[model samples]
Target: MKIKLYCRRALMTLLFICALYTTISSISNITLADMKVWAERVQQETNHPSENSLKKSNLEQKTMNEQTYRPKTLEEAIDFDQYETATVLATGYTAGIESTGKTSEHPQYGITFSGVKVKRDLYSTIAADPDIFPIGTILFIPNYGYGVVADIGSAIKGNSIDLYYDTVDDVYSQWGKQELDVYIVEYGDGTLTEEALKALNEAEALQVFRQQYIEQ
Candidate 1:
């Protein structure tokens, strides 16, 4: 009988020890889970961009890259319109710099004239009345290179223009008086040409011309 009681007591003690160990293990598991959750929350609190923010930033950068800011050539200028103030669809003929070597000596704007300025003798120089074409205007001649309306001449009236030449040979040899298609690219105040037309409409000498050519 004594042996049986001893064996039974020992078995009960073992069972109690196992139960206590299980309880402790459960608590440790819960603590570990809580620690993991806290760590994840701290990570989120630190400075880090979310997936949505990263995507939006990338999209904005892409938009900027795709935008064409400034046009370098006439073909490129046609693709952009934000800088355009007025669009003139007209045709006329081209001449050379006036005689007496005036343009070569005293250039109006020093490599430029009126408000138009560019490098000396790099691109084809076109001169037009400031009242009509204004300074700082871009002209796209189909067969010719992109030219700036950087000068004016006394003979350059109505739709006439004088293209400058580096040498007298070029003046007489190539570009003397040739018909050209003029596309005037204007910017800034945007009202110069329109205002000039308004003034011409009120002129008495232009009455007949306005009815035939200017109005159209």
Candidate 2:
């Protein structure tokens, strides 16, 4: 009887140990499976970004472009648009007899063909062909700044323009002559004053000028 009881106790202890081992193995397997699934999810996210991340990248690029862009030229900086362009042979002149053939003693010595006194300081006086750029037209030259078409010359025809200077020295030293591309910023009313008509009145030119410009 004593031997049977001792054998039964040993059998129960063995069964308990087996049950504990089986439970530990199942827990380890479940933990390993969960870890594998988590690692795969991390790798997928690294390979392919979400739509929200792509949108954020695009926004950053657009902002960078805006910050880098800048205005290049004077016209662009001032937001001024050119009405037309011309390639001109530019010449400099002064109010003296050497340039305008009119002495200071003359009645219309410093007066322009458009009947206004020359504004030599601003370089706002230019002689152009009335047929091309009429009186009051405004132009922008690269090296010489701004000039207004306020005069005409017998020699200034076609794409030739004459810029005004305060002195003959300025004419030679500042700007002798140049071939340049000029911007026409604004056009004139195409109307000439009575004094302008008188100044431009060469017999043949007057007849044509009257028919084309004055009559209309």
Candidate 3:
């Protein structure tokens, strides 16, 4: 009888241990899920919403559902401009990142430099070829460059270009307030199509920017 009782008590202990393990495992999974949700919410709140975010979310869902996610090939990624209004604006170094000791928010995203400092109100200048370049067109700088169209400048009225320098030292040493040639790549249909604008509007692009600021 004593041996029977001992066996029963041992069995009960084992069952309790198994239950504790399962509870711990469940709590761990919940914690991880909560962290992921928090990160996503932070991203949506900070960056402007756009098609990029939509695409990314779709990709994430596809990956979860289908177990795979792949980006477009280099050739597929290249967007060529075809609109008659499309123009090639002169390019220059984006100047502020390395100089300011800050990394780019989006390395793939490109912009024209308007001045040495980021203005109090995000004001800056671009090349004087707005007729060719237009105000809202986006361009890619090969390296050491970064920017977005926040505002235009009076002095930067024409084919002339402005370079961004994070600090006075950067202005003198790295940028030197010079003009450089920038290449404009065309993406999607000609004339800054709604799709292209939507692409720009996507949350992924803004999320990239937010990440940069957060790290800084």
TM-scores of the models, in the given order? Answer: 0.37, 0.53, 0.31
Model 1 TM-score, 2 decimals: 0.37
Model 3 poorest 10 in a row by lDDT: 115-124
TM-score computed on alpha carbons, candidate 3 = 0.31
Q: lDDT of each prediction vs. the true structure?
A: 0.51, 0.74, 0.43
Order the candidates by TM-score, highest first: 2, 1, 3
- lDDT, residue 65, model 2: 92
* Candidate 3 wrong stretches, greater than 4 Å: 1-129, 185-202, 205-216
Worst 10 residues of 2 by lDDT: 207-216
Candidate 2, residue 1: how far the Cα is off, in Å: 82
**Order of candidates by lDDT, top first?**
2, 1, 3
- lDDT by residue for model 3 (73-185), tens: 32223342332222223333343554333456754233333222232111122333454445444444322222233234455555554444344564455445434444444
Candidate 1 clash pair list: none
Of 2 and 3, the candidate ahead on lDDT is 2
Task: Residues 29-83, candidate 2: write the lDDT tens digits.
Answer: 6554676897987787679877887899899999999889754444444433435
